[model samples]
Structures are given as structure tokens and as C-alpha cells.
Target: MRVLVVGGEATIGRHVSAELRRRGHVVVTAGRSSGDVRVDVRHRDSVADMYREIGGVDAVVAPAAHGTTDRLQTLSRDELLQNMQGKLLGQVDLVLLGQHHAAAGASFTLTSGIFADEPWPGVTGGAMINAALHAFVRSAALELPRGMRVNVVSPTMVGDSVDSFSSTFPGMRPVPMDALVTGYLSVIEGERTGEVVRAYG
Candidate 1:
């Protein structure tokens, strides 16, 4: 399968891209500063341009998004909006615009995180965005055209980032990057849609 992986420079994204390659799938990585193609999901024009450049693909995987980690009290309205624009709508718009550019049976695998269910202090913005993405996938799956499929992968803190987030996620067991990548693989390869494939350890 020919795959386009957005945010493919990140740790999880890299793992997903490599694993797909190992399985004999052709993978194209796209991101703002890295990857084979440049795309800033926060901008609709950039996303549209990306799809135009790539034409058609079997799958589009987004393994990264941005959200604020500041305390609720310190977060301004603009910050919250930025978080929503960058993580929630940014990813949703990708699917909305890429649908026409995707192949007949193309699939979209979006990324959320364990925060949707397992909330932590200073991450309310991320939690809300993750929850919203889950909801979007559930509803969008029912209305997608041409047999297109959409799913979200909600993973716990990955082992690769545990050192940095360990204090924030104290006592939480981090899932290995490999294990989390499997959640994405399942959505890319499986027929099930509107599902939240959880990779919580």
C-alpha cells in the first residue's frame, strides 16, 4: 500500500513509518519542517496543497498534533483556541480536504492520546481535543464516501517520551513505541471504522 504519514518526523511517527516500510508498504512522510512533503496541518491551504502535490494514496496517517500543557488558570482564551486549531481542527480538516485526494479504498488514521480518558493536571486542552477527535471519528465514519475509513489511535505516554513526561504522569506505565505503532497499523490495515484504537499500557 502507498501511505502518507503526517508528522512522520516525530518518534511515534518514525516508528509507524518504519514499521509500514518493513511490511512492504511504501510510506511518504509529511510535516511542517521534515518528511518527504511539507505540510502544516493547522492551515487548510497547506493541507490542500499537500494533497494536490501527492495526488492519491492508499492511507493517510497522522501521528502527531499540538496542544497546550499549561495550567488551566494560566491558559488564556487564545491559547485554548490555538490548541483547538492546531490539534483538533487541524487534523479534522486534513481528512475533510484529503478525502477527494485519497484513493478509492483509502484509510485515515488520526492520533489522539490517553489524556482523553486519563486526564492530568495542566493538560486539559489536550484532553478536550483528544475527546473531540474521538467524537469526530465516530460520526465521520458513518458519513464517509466511497468506502473511505477513518479511525483514531489513542495511545498512552510512549516509552520514548517517558523521561520527559514521567513527572507529569507519575506512576503511569508508558506504552512502548512499537506497541503504540500497532494501533495505527490496525487502523490502516483493518476494515473497522469509527473506532478508537487504544494503546494504553
Candidate 2:
């Protein structure tokens, strides 16, 4: 299978990309500023451009999102919108536009986070966006045409980035990137749709 992994240069995305390659699947990586192709998911045009460049693929995995990390009190309206524009609408836009570019029976795996189910300080924006993605995946799955599938991966703090996030996610046992990648692979390779595969330790 040929797979396009957005944010493929990042920690989790890198793991997914590597594992897919090891399984003999052709992989293409895309990001805003890195990877085999560039895509700013916040904009529909950019997402469309990315699909045009890649042509069509059997799977599209997104392990990246852009959002603000400020407390609710300190978050401005613009900051809240920024998070929605990127993480929530960005991934949603990819699915909407990608339907036209993906092959029959194609699957889309999107990334959410533990914050959607568990709260932490200064992550209101992220939590909301994550939860929204989960809901989007569930509802979108029911409407997708031509055997398309949609799912979301909600992973806890990743072990590789524990140093940077441990303080924020106190008491949270960070899950290994390799383990989280497995959940993504299930969505990519399995027949499940509208599922929220949790990778929590």
C-alpha cells in the first residue's frame, strides 16, 4: 500500500513512516516546512495542493496539529480561532478535499491526544480541538463514500517528548512512539472506521 503521512518529520509521524516502510508499504511524508511535500492544513488550498502533488494514495495519516497552549483565561479570541483553524478544521479539510484524490477504499488516520479525555493546565485550546476531531471522525465516517474510512488516534504524552511535556502532564505515563504507531497502523490497515484508537499507558 502507498501511504502519505502528514507531519512525517515529527517524532510520532517519523515512527509511523518508518514502521510502514518496514512493512513494505511505500510512504510519502508531508508537513508545513518539512517532509517529501509541504502542506499547511489550515488552508484548504494548501491541502488541495498537497493532494495534487501526491496524486492519489491508499492511505493518509496525520499526526500533526497546530494550536495555542495557553490557559483559558489568558487565551485570546484569536488564539482560540488559531487552534480551531489548524487542528480542527485543518484535518477536517484534508478529509473533505482528499476524498477526491484518494483511491477507492482509502483510509484516513488523524491524530488527537489524551487531552481530549483528560484535562491539563494551559491546554484548553488543544483539548477542545482534540475532542472536536474525535467527533468529526465519528460523524464523517458515516458519510464517507466509496468504501472510504476515517479514524482518529488519541495518544497520551509520547515518551520521546516526555522531557518537554512531563511537567505539564504530571503523573501521566508517557507511551512509546512505537506503541502509538501501532494504533495508527491498525487504522490504516484494518477495516475499522469511526474508531478512536487510544494509545495510553
All candidates' lDDT scores? 0.89, 0.90
**Candidate 2, lDDT over the whole model:** 0.90
Worst 10 residues of 1 by lDDT: 64-73
* Model 1 lDDT per residue over 118-156, tens place: 868888888988999999999999988899999999988
Residue 10 deviation, candidate 2, in Å?
0.9
In candidate 1, stretches whose alpha carbon ends up further than 4 angstroms from where it belongs are none
Could you tell me the lDDT of residue 98 within candidate 2?
92
Clashes of each: 0, 0
Query: All predictions: root-mean-square deviation over Cα?
Result: 1.0, 1.1
TM-score of 2: 0.96
The candidate that achieves the highest TM-score relative to the unseen native structure: 1
